[model samples]
Target: MEAGEHQAVQLCLESGALISTQQHDLSTPVHLACAQGAMDIVRLMFSRQPDQRGASMNATDKEGRTVILLAAARGAWKTVTALLRLDADLSVKDNLRRNLLHHIVLSGGLLDDFHGEINERLKDFGDLLNERDIQGCTAMHYASRNGQLKTIESLLHFGAIVNLKNNENQSPLHFAARYGRYNTVRHLLESKKGHLIINEMDGEGKTPLHIASQNGHTRVVHLLLVKGALLHRDHKGRTPLHYAVTNGFTHTMEQLLAVHSHLLDQSDRDGNTALHLAAMHNKANTASLLLSLSCKISHNEQDFTPIDYALHYKHSEVAMVMVTHPSRSEEVMSCRTKRYTCLVEGLTAVMPEVMMVKHSFQALQNTEGVGDIVPETDQPLPVMNIMVRYGREELLSHPLCVKYLETKWNSYGMYFHMLNLAVYTVFLSFLTTNAVQLMAEKTDRENFTQVTSAQLASAFVYPSTRAKYFLDIMNVLEWTLYISAGLMAAGHLSTAVVDRSNQYIMAALAVFLAWFNYLLYLQRFNRIGLYVVMFLEILSTLLKVMFVFSVLIIAFGLSFHILLAKIDMNVKTPVFDPFTGNVTMRSMNMSDKGFHNPVISLVRVGTMMLGELDFLGTYLRPMRALESSAWYQIVAATWFLVVFIVLMPILLMNLLIGLAVGDIETVRRNAQLKRLTMQVELHTDLERKLPRRILTMVDKTEVYVYPNQKGSSSYVSVPDTKHVFRVHSSYVLRD
Candidate 1:
């Protein structure tokens, strides 16, 4: 391993004891000498044998590292010079396809005093100074990437191009910026001829500024910015500020923002600003910084705002910051936004045992005596509806409640009443016309049903007609629309069939309106009458189930009627003639009429299921003579047994009972909510009939403060509608 021991190896080689020694990796004696910077041992190995010199000098190790390449890489100046003098080819490369110059450059800071001589020797090859490896990186790239300032200067002095691009189209400046080499980046930018283009872009259109900003290289970012690196968008339309904010480089972000304040609102290809990126990544401090800069929170192409992203990613802290952002707090409390917030917040399930009742907050009296007495109609406020309903009474009187109460009707709400009125008037007129048509039809009932002239004249002449008309008001309207549309369709397909669904819809509308009219009058006792509505809902479900099961009954009736029809019918049965071996038949008079008609069969099956029929008399005795055949009578009896005993009595009856009992509690618990929902719907429909201008006069402003919380609130005052307040409280509004 030492330079002095080569003489012993020479003596062994001369005596023909051995030619050479090599390790498993194929590293020869010359390779070890060159790797260890033993220039004397390398000379001895070359001179100790004549024919071995060529193989020893040019031999590639397992990794394809030649002696001279290793010598140059290890800064073995004498060994490298000796190998070169002995005709070592500088063109030979390692497995990495790096030539001697590439290796020399890769040897960062290792080549100290011999750097000049090595550089001079490698520079003499001319093109080797700029030779690119397999990845198309020149020696200068390696020097720049490894922070070899002196080597980089030497290479550049030897005519290395400062802006030479690699396979990724990245210049040395990109490598320097990415690795955070502040001195190298400065030197590259301050090249004597200004050869380095400060704004040069890579294949991804990213400049050094973007790279440095992304990597949080503060000093390098400053150097690039001071060198007039223009802010340019990459392939993703992201600028350096976008990179800084996305990567959470606070210092770099501040510097970029300070220099380019206009980028505060710049959006990427996704329409996401730096603030949006910060929020999505849960960079709270960065988001706060951007919020402080008054960055506008705009929606992306997907209609997602920065706050939406924050909530979607479950970044609760970031979402809170965005939702409570000072600039948008008032906007968040606007009518449209507040309505959505309240609806969503109200629906979140809290305690399971809480009864289905609306909840309200009880505001404590403030010093200014501004608190309302929390009237029955005006509990805490609609904003506290969810908190009280879910038993989060602590938050019921929070400041957010005041903010929610500040929400007023949007400008569109001003015209909502007018639109509703127009719709209501149009439908009301249709209903009236339908009623008249129905009355006329009834007066002309001779067309549809037999009627005496005396009765018709009485209908035309007396007040009894009004009583009849009022009695059949809903039915008359529905039938009028139905028959009129049908008659019109019969006259011409295009006449009324074109909007047949519309006609049915109108008929249904009339029916519901009649029902709702009763509900409106019963609003005085809606709490008591809501039970009726819940019952009707349950009854409707039962009816739907009966409708479905009725088909099964019809199916079984038809199938079994046809099946049992031949059970005891008078028909000829085939038999064999014993003498001639030919077919013959015998006729029997059978009189089993139990399943003679499908309707009658259904009746029998129904009676049997109710346990009201004597099985022996009704079913067995009727088919008594057929029992001699055994199989037919047995199958028929078994069919009857399964249907009456198993299917009808046990399976279907229990299933119906279970269905009804399962949802009874659900229906009861949801009764009040459903009633409130229906009442709100009806009131909303009626409210839409008011004039737009009148609605504008009515509580268009959002905020209303009581006498107690007057100075504590920060909402614009709605002076007109302040006297009366409304709470969606279950106890006050319903009970």
Candidate 2:
């Protein structure tokens, strides 16, 4: 048995047996029953020991807390009513010297389903309202700490002192402001009896404003200022503005500045203004705002002028504005020679190749545009006539041209153009060796067959019939390749110029170019020819990636690098002799640096392989990979048909709806919690005044006390074992 679970005399009667008499170590049955709000047990126990009631009611527990004080602390309002009905002492103090009202205020009072029942309970015990604990903290102190705004208002209405200071010389308003109870502060300010805004200082000599600023409570600062709380300097001679800026309370600074701009120029004991602090900490926006307000700078401050501070710390943007001021232009000009020396030193830091590529690309983009060319004639001209009119009369001696002209014009003319050029050079080297083999070849042989394909494939006699046929095919292919290549090159050139204004358009064009190159590669069927096409495709893709990547790198890196170089120039050595500078530069070894990461190398290699795959796959359709054979053809016919036919858009629409619904639920939960908090504050403010009202009704002895119990309950009792056995045996005999 625990110390407080002793067998009371009243428990023997309830159990229908006389047990051994045992005394509780700290408290009797009445104390335990009242503290936990066990009302039925208290009533039964008190009825049996009517004479023991008064002594049990006044008994203190091991912790020196009275039963009523404990009940109030645990919010056992029903048990409190039972004890008070038996005339329990309400004036008793606990070990900490806190009274019943103080405990009630701390527990946020009893939880009640009905507000009327709560009002009745407070109306019965209102005389204990003015009682202070051992620490000189009243009921109002606990209410303020727990953010019980309604209870705080009630306490003030009951004549509880609102400005009363505790052991720390801090009042209720101080507690309210410190904990960010804005509504509670507003309530207290509105209460005529409550001090509008207590300027009382704590042990550290910090006023409420100092605490508010240090804690980043912008609303509290604003409230205090509205209620006329002095923004007074403390023992350290620092005002609220100094604290707000020093602690980086940007919102608080804005609030304070809205009413007081003179504080912007105010300096601390170190003689540094707010701008100086903002600059030192690299707070660019804050520094700019302060400078715009015309904050005065201390000229005598050592090595810490705003401009000097910015330059030393490498804030070139801020430093530029400060140094270029009309009043400081002379100083800036006097430092020009030094600036030039710094500029030369800065230029030495950049890589030379990077500079060259940047300048070359810029020059190419600045040239004028020319329109496309249209062919002048549709009919094929004779080779001799073309050679004579073009002023190249050497065609008669050219055997390839003479043979091409003798062969009647056919579709092979296109092939002859390319083959003739190759043959003329070959014939010039071996004039007498191949005349018979060259003239015996046939030009028109559709699906030409041979005993050994390699013999015919390897037979390369230029100006021969087979050679002319192959040359004709190449000439047609070359014209197509040139046309596609020109379009792609022109698109990229336009993108480079337009990218300066619109990045998204350039990105789209880059993607289109990748797909276009893939299509071009697919038209070439032979392996060697495929390799040549793929190489060109990879080159084009790499150029696009490099173009975009280089633009981004330069856009971000150049800004930072320029700012750093400018700052270094302004702060470092003023000037150096050109001869000495060149000698010093030559003494240092600066080359032999490159990107050494394996991952970057692997990524580059992987991109090239993917580009090759893209080129090859463009021609060969992977029909086996599709679910249905028709899918392959459908996809080949129209690219976007696969997605639209598969209901992808409907799935995306459902996903978006789910996300929007979840966001709405989150907003609703936040609003509910806020409402609950406000209601709790309002309830507390109402409960505090209940005590004083009860004191006014002291003359009426028929005080009606209604207890409100808010938690759930369960009943348990011991069963009779012997009676249960008798009942079971009688039923078995009857059966």
Candidate 3:
């Protein structure tokens, strides 16, 4: 049975040897003959075992490969035909439930060779042509996955269903995309049911485009996108764009963006957009590409933006790129109004829009992945502080946003804000008065209690949470109220001298900051707020400037320390020796003391930026003192000061001033709007924290708003002339 030759099988049969129904491996003589495509050996075996023909032909091997099925699958068409003549069971399937066609296609053979009688033999098993494998995949799916284009067409010609789904409900197109078979995918798109299956999703609600994108198959992705494949999300509400961004597939991302740039900003269920994934994955180059394409920096449901993700994940370079990208995207520049239409039934305003657009709405509701968002309009902000905190103040400039600001300001917002500010002033006043008293004052307990109670009540009404407070002013007054209260409490709790000293110091600081914060209250008005807004804008720009110059400052600091740190620069000066009671020349160290510490050295160099050169004290005095030591050291130190002055003070400082001055006009325009946004935020937070019973008791009167309304016009009654010659030229001339 193992030897597949006609003569050997014939000799064995003629000798009257009993024909074994099967071998050890369960392969019979018919199985070996079909496996080798030996039609003569197969016919001899079948004739020799005429009584056992069905048993020999229908028996399966270890892998459950049947005789006739094995022959067809292994391209033994001749032997398959011979087995058919011997009355082989046509309905026999392998253990995998695969039929004759499934075997042939899985063998990766082209069906073009099935001609004449072989073609006739396959047509009788029409149902087998569409029979599914264990995985619910058909022969067409196998052919497509293996890129057997000819075999796919041949199977189609043999009555194969073009859009037949496996148990997985996935079509041949889906299989083709899974393997990145570009040609097969294109052909499937051009097939009879091509359009129907292009966007057809699998059991997981994933489309062929999703599979191709997930695998980073750029060419297949391009073909799918070009074919108008819908940018649908899967059951998880993730789009093809999301899949491509998961692994930083740059080219695939580009293809998806080309077809639907809107998907770039579309968020998944978590509200995370594509850029957030790029940052989280540390795809710096991908982030830069996204920015160049005008992708918006959006916050997800957790209120975290792409930059936040990058910084959190330690992708500093990605954070920098995102932060430096143009704040205004293409969408911002192109913001325009469209003539809106209402989807209503019966062409009447009173008609329920759901009757006309219910199906459309349900489709959107059913769509798991993609959505259209108008964040500034559709998504409501929980608090207004988010705008100023995240530098989203630009949103206040939109026309609709302006209307929201107006409506919010008019509806109890103004009164709430004014009342909140009054409370904050009283709180700051109490903090200041307590701080001014001595640390161990006899009435310290009373003063401390007053301060705490005032702030506690103020916080219950409205907490003055600061956002990006002045960095320089923090040197003296960072969290002044909190620090002062803490020190006062500490002093009251312990009579330690150190605590007492800190109490007085913090007290003095609290008084200064209270005045400063009180001064800022003038910003509540529009005209003064312009200067305050401009100050903050300049301060922000200055922060960026400080960041960029930090490297230069460090470089200069380390160099200054290396060159002059150990130098003995003693200024020779006349001094009185008290012990001897006589005047004498004494050498005094004239070198800058800060050079001993790198931090102090950096501060000294940074101060040069503000025109605090210390030229005479550090450089000139040292040069004079060191003249007697070495002229070379003096020259080097002098030249170093000159270079530092030109770079730090002359160059960057002047440029900063120019930039700050240029911000005036823009500041003037946006200042009022920014203050309004801030005002609304303060009031909103206050109102949200109000007692529920008090809120219930509040007035329910409505405030009507009319946007962009033109001035009303009325006409005066006038007499009309009845006759044609009435009010003729002569009468007009007389008048």
Candidate 4:
């Protein structure tokens, strides 16, 4: 029937092959034919079974549309007229109690084809025109939902109420706007004028504007705006502007915001403004627009900003927009920029997913806490912990991370830092004293025992995850210093005379190495810490530069040895026995420099690279009389000097100097940012040493402290210990 297969449908009816058959929808041949607008096929089926009239023709399928209703909906005019002539129940409603008009309007069909004849058929049936379906949607609702302008117009002309709401309380205009049916929306507004409920909200408290904006229907959104569809917030407290931003419709957002510009910065229930949604969704253009409006860095209830969302979601483009936003620092912030600002607040989600612990990002609110309340292993490792490990400047520089570290620092950080510094200093002092005793050819067994015990305690206290634990350079250095010191002590107790020198050598190694460990603790001061961090960064760059230019330095060094033969050797000394009257072996002095061999020649090149030109006074002061004066040799010597100077000092040295300057410049610009990052790491190391009682205290989960609070600012969580006691000072003690 749908294929206009009149012959096939007629044969099926005549043969009685499918006359008794029904489809999955229980749709018989005639019902299928009517739905497809195959009036001829429907007629043949009816002709074959004349007795199948009233009950058979009026019977509803699964969806409850009768044959006549379906035919009229499909514009099958002849089928509907025949059904009406057979006294078909025009007043009969579907399972949903929708009459013929509902289906006709929903599917866009001519309802008044036989209006003059049908008027008599339903003389007392004017109420059927306004009948409601099971969903309480009238014919007008369906018409608007289907975007049928003609049907909407005809219904309004026939006294159909325009603002009739469905079970969801969604009016005709609501359906029209939701489906982006601008034509019907315009017709409804034009037809009903003031009577049309343009601003009617659905069950979700969303107006047509919200729906249109969410679906990115810019035209429909404009039409609704012009038609007075008020920008309203839904149950989630999201405005139409929120919807526009979420869908990344910049133009639609522009249209909405232009009408009500003040809602641009208004936060919803979650404390998320239009800008937050834009950043979360990586809508760079939308973010740029929001930023252009001087949108401030408003923190959500979770204390996350738009840039936080951008960084957490790995939206670099969005982050760049927010970071470079002209008003980032200039725009007035909420409680953040105040000089007396206090932080009893912060959030967890910070860095991008690729940098996350599990390689997936989830907001703290969405992260399910472990063991009823303790935000333990299940949560993303504490934000500061992640910052220390992952090292995102954006995250580390965030005020929340900074505030957290500051709070920790001001609370008990100084005490913890001083305690550890005192312990390490004692150990260093012991190591130094033992090295000094060995250097003075003395013994101090008590000092040696103390140093060895500290080393053993350190190794034992370290986490058993050795691969990750030992990866720390400090850990490696600690083991080296302690083991060397122990070996030095062992040599002192031995009777072997040759072991004394080995002991001295080992003692020297331990003393100097202990100083390098002090660099790790240098982060306590921001000025020094930032330099240390920058120095590490610059050192990495320096290594690469040196590695690449090593060949040039060696080439020049070897050429120097070949070009100038006079500066050939470091020293020519001989070890001899006077009684034997013979020289045993030649000795080479290492504390001297000249292009004697490849190694010393390369050393000369390295010295020249560092701007140490010894030849200026020794060789070049007065052109030494050449043993074999040749002009070519003179030219070679002069030209090689110039080439080495150009490559090493002028080019390579400046490059190295310029690289350091550039790093210094960057550090200068982001000095505060770098200090904040360093503080986070320092505090992380400090916090890790804290007891579980301290870690658990605060908001019954993670410990938080307000350094500036009037009273005791820490919210301590009483651990689930069997026996616990509180002292007069409110200090908690547990077994």
* Best by the TM-score measure: 1
Every candidate's CA RMSD: 24.4, 38.1, 23.7, 19.2
Residues 657-692, candidate 2: write the lDDT tens digits.
Answer: 454444553433333322222222222222232354
lDDT for each residue of candidate 3 in 1-735, tens digit (9 for 90 to 100): 566656777888898854545678888766777789877766676677777776776779887878888887778776766666666676778888887778778777656655554456665667677778898988888999999988877777777887889888899999999899999999889988889999999999999999999889999999988888888888878899888888778899888888788888888889888888888888767787887887777778887766556545556455434433454323321322121132111112332211111111122123232223323332223334445545676654533344445444545555775786788788887776666566435545776677777766655565434453334353235355555656665566566733666767766766776676666656654456557766776778889988988888998888777666777745666878899999998665524357767788887777767877767766677676565556566567778878888888888788888877876767556665666666655445555566657544642323222211234111111112122111111111211
Higher-scoring candidate on TM-score, 1 or 3: 1
Scored by Cα lDDT, where does model 4 land?
0.65
Separate clash counts for every candidate: 7, 14, 0, 1
Model 1 agreement with the true structure over 336-367: per-residue lDDT tens digits: 22123631242222211111222232342121
Greater lDDT among 3 and 4 belongs to 3
Q: What Cα-based lDDT does every candidate model obtain? A: 0.60, 0.48, 0.67, 0.65
Clashes of 1: 7
Measured by TM-score, how close is model 1 to the native structure? 0.45
Candidate No. with top lDDT:
3
Please report the TM-score between candidate 3 and the true structure. 0.42
The 10-residue segment of model 4 with minimum total lDDT is 726-735
List clashing residue pairs in candidate 3: none
Question: Model 2 TM-score?
Answer: 0.41
